[model samples]
Target: MDVVQQRFAEWVYKLGITLTERQAEQFETYFRLLVEWNEKMNLTGITEREPVYEKHFYDSLTIAEAVDFNKTSSIADIGSGAGFPSLPLKIAFPHLKVTIVDALAKRIRFLDEVIAALGLDNVTALHGRAEEVARDAIHRDHYDVVTARAVARLSVLNEFCLPFTKSGGVFIAMKGTDVEEELRDSGYSAHVLKGEAREVLKLKLPLEQSERHLVIIDKKGSTPKAYPRKAGTPLKSPLVDPAASQ
Candidate 1:
């Protein structure tokens, strides 16, 4: 095993998870593809080898804890730039039906190439904005789980993710330590997404002192059709708080 693969394996094992050889190879291939493609595209800034392992690979793998793979079959990574948790999670759980959505055609092109190179059968990369795709009957309310990483403010992120989540599905946002403040600021936009903050899981990464928060929101009911409200409106006119309404 190469140094990178060995280190990744140790990290996953320490996280109370195990990866088969096939899974590890998938990650290795993904890392190679990311690095190769990044040379030409602005896929990610963390190009150094170690940083790629920690920030890209490990950071993406952290979502495994928040998600129940047994119950989850379909997942959509909204705004999945360079295929973070979606591709990694799919590697870990090969049965997962994963779709990565990115608005930028370039990023989607990169993702498609990576998917093809990896021979990943269960994943699809879609090129379109989340707001537009989430409204389509095929995408709207179809996923078992939706994930986003540093996509937007909690309020805006909710709008982008929730529309694609099934009523019982969950949207897991990989966030930094400021999740509490973001959630507080989200307010009515949270309600508009038909979701509520379910729980926050604090995580520790190897050699990283900074904290990370996985904000899990459960989609409790149907989001009102009027929601997401065009491109710029959710951030501008969030729903009225029910408590404030009272």
Candidate 2:
């Protein structure tokens, strides 16, 4: 393995994740594909080799620190723009079954190309808003774990992601440091969506030292059919703690 690849493997190795030579090659191929397609579309601003490895690739793999992939069967990534945690997790744990949901068709095409180039299996890239797609029985409450990056606030994420989480499953939200206020604001939504706040796993990027938090919310029951409201509703009208307004 080259220096960049070796460093990445070592970082995850500390997390108890073992990467074989093939997986390392797949990650390298993914990096090349990401930089290549990024020229045509606005895939990601963080395209440099090492930075991509630290921020996107390693950051995605950190989910393993919170939940064990060996025990988890399926994961649905909601609003997986450019396929963050799900794609990398699938690469590391070949046994995982991954479903990536994103609203943009162009990004979906890019993800499809990456999956093909990587020669990955059991991965599906769907183009649609998370709200509508989670309503489908095939996807709704079907995954063992649901993931979303800091794409939206906690309350909004709860609405968009909880529907895709099966009962007794967990929705893991990857967020930055400003989580205290978000947790306070998200109480009602979590309760309403049949989700309970669990724990947050804190860690830092190997090189950058930027703090990242994994907000783990346990799904107690199936999402109410009324949840997710509409494709654009959650973001515009995020649920807030009633007491805060009072």
Candidate that would win on TM-score: 2
lDDT, residue 176, candidate 1: 78
| Clash totals in order | 0, 0
Kindly list the per-residue Cα lDDT of model 2 for residues 1-246, writing each as its tens digit.
Answer: 989999999999998899999999999999999999999999889998999999999999999998988999899998898889899999999989999999999999999999999999999999999989988999988899999996899989999999999999999999988599899889899999999999988899999999999999999998897888987899998977767787
Error of 1 at 72 (Å): 1.0
RMSD of each: 2.2, 0.9
Colliding pairs, model 2: none
TM-score of 1: 0.93
lDDT of 1: 0.83
Tens digits of per-residue lDDT, candidate 1, 1-246, equal 688778888897766568888777777788888889989889998888777888888888888788868678999999899898888877777789998999889998888887887788978899887878888888888898999998888878889889888899999999877677788877677776788888999997786657889999999888778866686565566555668656
Candidate 2 Cα misplacement greater than 4 A, ranges: none
TM-scores of the candidates in the order shown:
0.93, 0.98
Alpha-carbon local distance difference test for all models: 0.83, 0.92
